[model samples]
Structure formats: C-alpha cells, structure tokens
Target: MRRPSALRRLSLHRVMTHADYVSTHVVGRSLLVSIAAIAVIHAFGIVTMGVSSTSALASMLLAAGMLYAILAGLAVASMGDDLGQGYASLYLAHPLSRAEYFAAWMTAGPLVVLVAYLLSVAAPLIALNPSSMLDASVYLPVLCIAGQISFHTSVAVFSSILFKDKSKAILALLTVIIIAPTLVVFVGGLLASAIHTVDIMSLVAKIVGVFHPAVFYMPFTPRGGSASLSLAYGFGASLILYYLGYRFFKYRTDI
Candidate 1:
C-alpha cells in the first residue's frame, strides 16, 4: 500500500487538533470563569485604585497564574486518560501516527491557554487604558507572560505523558509549578534563619529565579542583557521539554 502523503497527515493532525479543542471546550469554559475573575478584579482596581502600570502589570501576572493553575493539568489529563484507557490505540489504528496525536494535543492545549490569557489580560488592560496600546513597552511583557504560560503547558504535557494517568499527571504538574517553588522559598527562608544571615535567602531566591515561573513576575536583569533573556530561556527550555515529551510518548507510551 502507498504511504499517506505528508499533506494528508498534516491535515489529519489539524482535524485532530480541532476535535480536541471542541471536546475540551468544557474545560475552556472554566477558563472563562478565570478570565472573568481577572477582568472583574482589574475593573475593581480601576474603579477604586485607578489604572496604573503597576496595577495593569499585576493583573497581567495574575492572569498568567490563573492560566497556569487552571489549565495545565486538565489540558493534558485528557491525553493521559486516553492512553490509560486504550483510546489512543483506537486513534493510532487509523492513518494518524502517535506523533500527530501528540502534536494535536500539544497544539490544542497551548492554543486554549494562550487565547484565554489574552482575553483575561490583554483585552482588559488595553480597554482600561487605551493609552497603553500606544505605549511600546506593554507589548514585551504581554509576550513574555504568554511565553511563561507556554512553558507551563509544556511541563504539564510532559508530566501527563510521563505518568500516563490523570490524577498523577495533574499532581506532578502542580507540584512542579506551585508546590515545588513554594517549598524552595520556604527552604531558603529556613536556611537563612538557621545561618542568622539574610544572604542565604537571597541566594536561594536567585536560584529559584533561574528556574521557576514565579520569577517571571519579579524584576530581574542579568549582568549585560535585558529581562528578555529570561523570556529566551523560558521559550528555549519549553522547546526542549516539549520535544522530550513527544519523544517519550512516541517511543515509550504503549497506547
């Protein structure tokens, strides 16, 4: 039999991605609640505190937190469940390869997160302060925030494939994103206290700043370069993890 053409395979992948989005739109609805919450909070700030760059930036980061917390695990749990339940085998039985299935999911999951994030942060901030649109400075932070969300999405997808179970994948993903960072800070604090010096906490904070998403919210600049270097790191690490997830899924995942 003739092999399927690359165009046909790509078309099938697109169709699969659309189907995943449709199926997961319920979860996407839940993301709307997050977006609404961000909008309401930002609106309240505008009413009471008035709009400022600080508040707008805070709201943007808040939206990123909400995006990571709400969608990360659930987005990829569907895939883990499919693998666990043998549903992936059904998909693989068709013209679709495992790589395409994985690609479809990776595309859909991030697409939902990105769209929800833009709605939650971008629309509200711009609407509240139309002048911000004229401000060239606003664009970089917005893109960086989106990049941060993409990083979280990659980690979540990798966790899902690694565990191959809904609950475990979600637990592991959240542990990495939230709990692990919190514990790092806590340890840093404890170490600083034990040493009777503030230096240890600063050192640990710097370490966390290197790897954790929490650092994205804070201000940091390396010796020579600007903060955009952090964005480069985030996107670069995400690509590595994304590929590792795909490799594992293609070679190791049974379904």
Candidate 2:
C-alpha cells in the first residue's frame, strides 16, 4: 500500500525504494535486532533478570536512547556509502527525482527505528508490570520517544545532506542530538530557572508538548519550570529540517 495524505503522491516505486534501502542496510537493521534481542532475552529471563521499577525505568531509558542509533542509521544508511564517496551521481542518475529520493528515504528511515525502539523499551516494561502502561511515568517516556525520534531523524537527515561525507554527517547529527537536548533541557532550563529569563527550554517544550500530553512526569522538567512540551516540537523541527534538506538536495546537490 502507498503512504497516505501528502505522501500519497509519492509513487509505489519510491516507497519500495525505502523498503529496499532499509533491507539493504546493516546498521539500521542491526540496531533494531539488538533492541529486539534485549527484549527477547528479558522475556526468557526466568532466573537471571527480574523486573522491577528500576529495571522498567532502565528499559525506558534504553528505548529512549535508541534515538542515538536512529540518528546514526538514518544519517549513514540512507546513502549506503554513496555519499561518503563524495558524489550523488549514482543516485542522481536514477529515474527518481531528488525530492522523491529524499521523501522516501525520510518517510521510511526512522520509522523502522521507532518501531524497534518502542517494542524494545515498552515490551520489557510491560512484561515486568502490565499495569505500568497505566502509569503516566511509564507511558510518558515512550510517548516522548516519538517526538525525540522525529527530531533526531530530521537532524540526521539534514546532516546527511549538509555533509556529503557519511562520517561527518553522523558526527553533526550526534553533536546536535546529544548536546542540544542537554543544553536545551538541562543547561537552558537551569539558566532560565536561575535568572527567570525567557523560558528557553519552555519554548522548545511547548513545541514538543504533544509527545507528552502531561509534561511533569519526566525528570527533565524542573519542579517549577514552564511548559515542557516535546513531541510537537520534534515533529515540527523535523518538518523544517526535511524541507531544508530536500531543497538543498534537489537543487544545490549537483556539487
């Protein structure tokens, strides 16, 4: 089946290309398999590991941390070492337009990671305590991951486009994904709290609020801080980056 809405215009062939891209890559697939493996190991752990609040929380963090792998996979796997060689001639020569390529690559890129991440993180927590899903503390982390993944995917894709070299793109994606979140949530949030200046983190939080309809559950939000929205911001930021990346790849990438 074809993707819906705006993406419906993308041909079936393009969608298949995305599937092909995902199937052909080792990094994204391996990351997904590793996450699934963790869940599998936990599911079978009758004697070794026991589920508890701490273990559940650890799984949640592990799932959230999948954002790092998502970024890495999307940044490097989409090109399949094509971008690292310093040219897009092989892809550009294809029947696909640059826009089509980018859309498909992005449309299907992080989705794989998202599914694996959710299952990996949530499966363990649920197995440990089925009622945990009812707890905002448990669900909030999973919810936030959606937004976080989107944000990181866009960042990685943008980096991939910004730098033709694979390694450099991955580096840029990591810098922003790792450093930006800390600075925005921790540093910026802390500074805002100290001086009561502009709600630096709040502004970002407001954008991603959809990710966590209720914002106070996570540890990132200071006790008295402003809004800590995350999902909407992640989706919104991704949209902007996707546009920029596509535009650049479409016209300026001839270089």
Candidate 3:
C-alpha cells in the first residue's frame, strides 16, 4: 500500500475534535478574561496618571504587571480541574502524536500572551505618549517583558506535563512565585550586607530583575540601560527553558 500522507496520518477528524474542544473549554474563556483585564488595568493607569511624562512610565509598568498576572493566571487556570491531564489523554487517544499536541499548545498559549501584552501595553502607551514610542528605552522593556512571559509560561507548561496532578501543578507555580523573589532578595541582600555596600545589591538586583516580567516594563530603566542587558539575559533563559520543556515532553510517555 502507498504510504499515508502526513495529513492522512494526522486525521482531519482528530484535528477538528481537538480544535472544537479547545474552543469550548475554559482555556478560551480564561484567555478572553485575561486580555480584558490587562486592557482595563492599563487604561485606568493612563487615566489616573493624567497623560503626563511620568504617567507614560507608570502606565508601562502597570501594563507589564498586568501581563505577568495574565501569564500566571493562564498557568493556574490550565492546572485547575485536571485540564492538562485531560488534554494529554485526548491527544494520546486520537491519531495525533505527542509532538503535534505540544506544538499546538505552545503555539496557542504564547500567541495569546503576546497579543494580550501588546494590546494592553504598546497600544495605550503609544497613544498617550507618541514620543516614548521613538525611545529605545520603551522597546527594551517590552522585549524583556515578552521574554519573561515566555520563560514563565514554558516553566508552567512543563510543570503541568510532568506533575500529572492539577494540585501539584498549582504547587509548582506557587513555589516559583514564593521562591523567586525571596531568592533574589536574599542573595542580593547577602552580597550587599557582606560588602557593606549597596553597589553589589544593585548589581544583583539588576541581574535578577531581567527574569521578572513586572520589572522589565518599569520606566526608570531605559532600553539602553542595564535593563536592556537584563532583558537579553531573560531571552537567553527562556530559550533554555524551552529546550528543557521540549525534552521533557518528548521523552515522557506516562502523561
């Protein structure tokens, strides 16, 4: 017999079923709510700040915080009700392969995050302060924020896949939330305290800040400043997480 075409192997029926399920699922609804929340929060910040020079900075930071919240919410929402287990089961039961299933999930999740971030942040910031648009500083923070979101989302997805239990996934997320800041502070604090100087803490703070989406969009640090370097570091960290996530998903069949 002639070899089945790629399309034939990935049956249209299976693809359609997956798409339908995703559309009807809470994931879609959660995405909508996240986007709306980001937009509303940023708009309020802009209005409250009164379109002043400082307001632009404040709005940018607010937008970044909203994006971080959305990303965290997405991870938590996916973990609730054993959604990841259900997704894995549905994909494995069908003609679809794990690779295809993962591809679809990764593609959809990041696109949602990116669109929501841009719509919530870039649109309003530019509208209120067009000059800020031309500043390299503005773009740098956005890049850092994007990197942070990607890295966190990847980690969350990997945790969901590996843990198999929704509660465990939630725990994983909470662990990250609780640990990251404290670790940063402790390390930075220790370095500064030991040296009897604030410079060491400032350096450590700048380094750790890159990994956080909320810190990236703050206007105090311009695009060409240390924040830019931190954003670059965030992108590099994100790549490593993506690779690890891919490896874990590729080899593990227990899901």
Give the winner by TM-score.
1
For residues 1-255, write the lDDT of model 1, one tens digit per residue.
Answer: 999854465766455664565355623656545555655564455434434554456454645454554464466666777778777777679877776777677656666556655665566566777777565455555565666667777777887788777788777667766777688889887788789745786566556655454354343421222346557766777888898998898778777
Q: Give every collision pair in model 2.
A: 205-229, 207-233, 208-229, 208-230, 208-231, 208-232, 208-233, 209-229, 209-230
Indicate the TM-score of model 3: 0.73
Q: What ranking emerges by lDDT with the best candidate at the front?
A: 1, 3, 2
lDDT of 1 at 105: 75
- Ten consecutive residues with minimal summed lDDT in candidate 3? 216-225
- Which candidate has the top score in lDDT? 1
- TM-score against native, each model: 0.77, 0.65, 0.73
Model 2 global lDDT (CA atoms, 0 to 1) = 0.56
For every candidate, C-alpha RMSD to the true structure in Å: 4.1, 6.1, 4.4
Candidate 3 overall Cα lDDT vs. reference? Answer: 0.58
The C-alpha stretches of model 1 lying farther than 4 A from their native spots are: 1-8, 12-18, 21-50, 63-69, 134-137, 196-198, 214-226
Q: Candidate 1 local accuracy as lDDT?
A: 0.63
Stretches of model 2 off by over 4 angstroms after superposition:
1-8, 25-32, 35-51, 54-59, 62-81, 84-87, 125-131, 179-217, 222-228
